[model samples]
Target: MRLVHVVTLVSEDGAYGGPTSVATGQLEECATRGHEVTLLSLWRGGSRAPAHIGSVPLRTRPARALLPGRFTGIMHPLLVGDMWRSMGRADVVHIHAGRDLVSLTALAVATLRRKRFFTQTHGMVEPRHRLVARLFDRLYVPLLRRARGCLVLTERERRAVSEVIGPQGPPLLTLPNGVRPEHDAEVERGPRAPEVLFMARLHPRKRPDAFVETAALVHRKLPGVRFTLHGADEGELPTVRRLIAAHRLWGVVSYGGALSYAEALRAQARAAVYVLPSVDEPFPMTVIEALSAGTPVVCTDTCGMADELARRGAAVVTDGSPRAMADAVCEVLTDENRRAGLVRAGRRAVAESFSIHAVADRLEEIYRNL
Candidate 1:
């Protein structure tokens, strides 16, 4: 099968976060299955796009912000041609779409060419009363109705997308983000380092500041405990730095810059606990990656995966507050038994429910049906 996957942006250090990671994982899995996979995307950072991922081919066009709002007005001039060629030749096109120009253009070309395509928005496309969101919806929602199906992460997301695309929209399917945990088996698991880790983009929604605050609070209780944050900046690093400085936690809370996907897993492997203070996150890939890495996970109760993770005892769900998060971190740090329980349950939950092989199997079925 010839499969084409499209995503909005590819940065030097994966600043765009989960959508890019998820798409790459899916396409690589497809490539290993003997499918001719092509990944088309807009490249940021002044460097060249990589040649390929495993056996899959990659095509990228440089992105430039020619107008207002860095991402909203960014344009990838030559990407439409790439989209036309790859999506036109594809047996199925899977677009990791958003309301941005790149994704909207991909949808337009795919629809205009009458290609068999599916869209997975990664909680990006949702109903909003904002003027920009309203405008973007008017442009893309009709195109979405022509899709074979739309994939969502949670029931909340499904409902939001439904409102955006309306009653006549395509079937909405809930698909879990898949992960590969084979490398986790190799981790030395006697006692992890006394480190609390947060890995995600440092955006306002991600709450990197909260991580710093949590670090401050945890330090008061457990002075030996260290906190590390690794993520690309999305206008929130300044706030995080300020909070760290204000709290006088310069060395205790180190800010490691953005990291590659492999590097993130390695960081998780060494950490005593992984914490994400972000709220309303729709199945945060980082939390699941932490789980797969055998790091006891701590995330907010409002994330899409919170209920299942809490029910399975796979993670400690918090209330998106530094105090709650710090308490959770402290508990995981002080109690060896509880920490071990979380690690065991987290790895089990990921293998049984969020394995990449199972996700690929479902994707294959969907492509065949299309």
Candidate 2:
């Protein structure tokens, strides 16, 4: 099977967030099973792209991809020609997000060409989006309903999307994200200077402000505790920096902008607790990475992965507030026995539920059906 992934961004760009990461994982699974795979993304501003994801071929083009109503990762208009050409070559065009202009272009092309296509619901059609965007989604829902199948990362996302489409929903397939354990050797997680780490993009939706506020609250009680925020400086970095400076959190918190996976793992290995304060995360891959690294997680109750983490005894889920998050982090940082238990359970959870090989076998079954 020759599969083409239509997404806003590819991993080559520094903004390799959840969607790109998930796509890369899926592509790897497909390719390793001997399926010909290619990723087509609208190239925005990035110095370069990664070499390849497992065995999949990756191609990105610069184009004007955004229109008036969408917040697409790739909004390059110059790439329409390339998108059409790529679609022509693919056996199945897997569309990742629908709000983007390039995605709309792909939707139209897939219809015109009578091609088989699938769309992965990365929680785009959620209630959290803007009113105007939600209204636009009313118009966009039918196009998605026409797809051959829809891949959902979590049951929460599936339910949210199903509410809108109801019985008319496309063929739904639930596939969770997989993790390839970063640490080969058993590296014990020790209490370092920075006891907690936030290893995700510094964006508004990620609720980096909450992280800043929580860190301040945590510092008030635990004066010696340290927090490190890592990931790329997107548009929200300035605001986060401003908040940190205004609140005088300079000494307590260190801003480590966008480290590579290896660098992120090094940071994760040192920290005792991993904190993700994202406001609307469907499922956080970082939580799994943290668990796989034997680091306990302190995340929001609203997180989809929090349920899984709870079952694994690898995380403490708090209310979606700075104070609550602060308390959770403090608890995770101080409780040695709980931390040790979570670390052991977290590693086991990763091995059983999120291992790459386990996830690959599941995805291969879906590919065969598709």
Candidate 3:
């Protein structure tokens, strides 16, 4: 099958995060299976986008910010030329949709041409009460109803999509993000320096400030222990630095500016524990990556996978409080037997449930059905 993915933005900083990563993973999987796949998205910065993902083609246009600040990732819609000639080649178009230009354009093109398409919102299009969200739902929900399937990560997300689509809409499919399998030669992990890591975009919703606070608490308990923060700044770096300075956490905590995807994997492999202080993180791909790397995880109870992770001894799920997160990280660092158990169980959990091969098989089946 000729599969085409419309991921919104491919900025230099990887500011698009999970949605882009997931879409490319599928694109590479399809390519490996001898299917012709293409990634169509917008790009920014001087470094230049990659030529391809594995063997799949990567086609892009420059992304320009019409509205400034946090809204820059979504470029002006008119920047792209008519891709009807391009969209005409696909058997199916898979949109990593949100209220973004690339996704909307593909939806419009596919609809006008009567082509089959699927949407996976990646927790972006919730039933938000804000004026922007309401306005977007007006345009997006109708296009969603026309899709072959609307993929959601969690049950809450399913309800959110359902509420927006009303009583009748597209077939809502539950498809979790899949991690690519690691070789058996992967490195072993344990308690080490940089005992805790907070890796994700340093945005307000992700609660990077809370991580800083947690670091201060953890430092007070274990003076010699270290904490590291690694991610691109999404308008919150200044605040994070201010908090770190205010708390006098200069030596106890270090900032490792930004990490590439490969760097992130390596960092997780060596770290003792990975913590994401964010609440309502539906399914944290970062935690899964850490688990796959044999590192223990610390996250909030509000995560979609928290119950399962905690039950299976794969992670320590807390109440998202700085105090709670600090306690969890310290425990993971000091408790040898418990830490090993978490590593073993986390790897097991990832292999059993989050493998990319199974997701690829299901996707192929879905494409054929469509």
Candidate 4:
């Protein structure tokens, strides 16, 4: 199979978080399986190119139009023609980031070429959109309808997109992100002291403040317990820092900066309870990674992972409230039998469902069908 993966950016250090990691993992696996793969990405002329990716051919082109100053918004019409010519040689064209100019160009190119195109919509165009963005989408809807299939990261997103596009909505397929298992062998067990960990961007919707307040509440009863926060700030860091300082939780609550995939796994391996504490999310890969690390998770029932968590039997899902999250974490951490059961279930879930190779098999089937 010959496949072309089109994304505006690819982070090699695993610094950009889950979506990048998932795409890289899947593309690399496809390359390893003796399939021909090509990567077309926007390369800002002065920026450094990735040093290596074995056996995969790559093409880098300068983005035609830069909008919001630094971001790629719309591609030049001529560039879309160039992209179409490139896709003419491939069996499949997979667009990873659908909001970018490269993606829009790919969609247009795929339609004109009558090529097999598949799109992975990370999240539906951030609910509130600029007028220009909406205009672009209106123009692109027809192209989306012509796609071989549309891939949605979560079931909710699939349903929402179906409603928006109606009969013209391309055949929707929901595939959850895949994660590699962190621990190959049994990790050394230590005396489990209950500690809560929150790992996500400090964005408004992530509700990091709620996580902190919940941690304070949990600390009142479990005096020795600690909470560790990870991930780079998006905008809510200042508020979270203020709350942490005012509470004099400088010692009990620590902020660990964004980490590599290995570092995140190490943190998850040490945690007694992993808390997502998100107000809303679209199929978080972190929740799956925490489960893969054999840690019990406490997350909102409103998120994409809620149903999966219940089915996996690795987490306690409650309402999207700090108090609810705290209570769930406390319940799991305080009971040895319950925690142990969750750990066992979580490991089994990852091995059976979320493993990279396991997901790649499903993806291969999709590619064949396309």
Selected candidate, larger lDDT, 2 vs 3: 3
lDDT of each: 0.86, 0.75, 0.81, 0.73
Best-performing candidate as measured by TM-score: 1
Instruction: Order the candidates by lDDT, highest first.
Output: 1, 3, 2, 4
Q: lDDT per residue, candidate 1, 6-47, as tens digits?
A: 988777877778998899888888888899898998787756
lDDT of 4 by residue, 222-281 (tens): 878899889877777888889888878887888887765567777777888989888658
- Residue-level lDDT of model 2, residues 1-370, one tens digit each, is 7888877765432365777777777787778778888887755454655556556677876645345532453466556666777778778888886576666767767767777888886887654467866776665777788888888878878887788666887877887777777552545555465477888877777888788889899998888988888887667788888888988988788887787655676788888688898876887878887888877888888898778878777688888799998888787777778778888888888888887778778766666676
Better TM-score candidate (1, 4): 1
lDDT by residue for model 3 (1-370), tens: 8888888877666667888788888888888899988888887658877887556688887777655435424665553443565668889988888876566667888888788999998888767787866776677678888999988999988988888787788888888888876722354444466568889898888999999999999888888878888888878889888998999988778788777666677888888789998888988888888888888899999998998898898999999999999998888878899989998999888888877778888888888886
After the best TM-score superposition of candidate 4, give how far the Cα of residue 322 lies from its true spot, in angstroms: 1.6
Residue 285 in model 4: shift from native, Å? 0.7
Instruction: Please state the error at residue 115 of candidate 2 in Å.
Output: 2.2
Error of 1 at 203 (Å): 1.6
Q: How many Å off is the CA of 300 in candidate 1?
A: 0.7
Q: How much lDDT does candidate 1 score?
A: 0.86
| Model 1: residues with Cα > 4 Å off, grouped in runs | 185-191
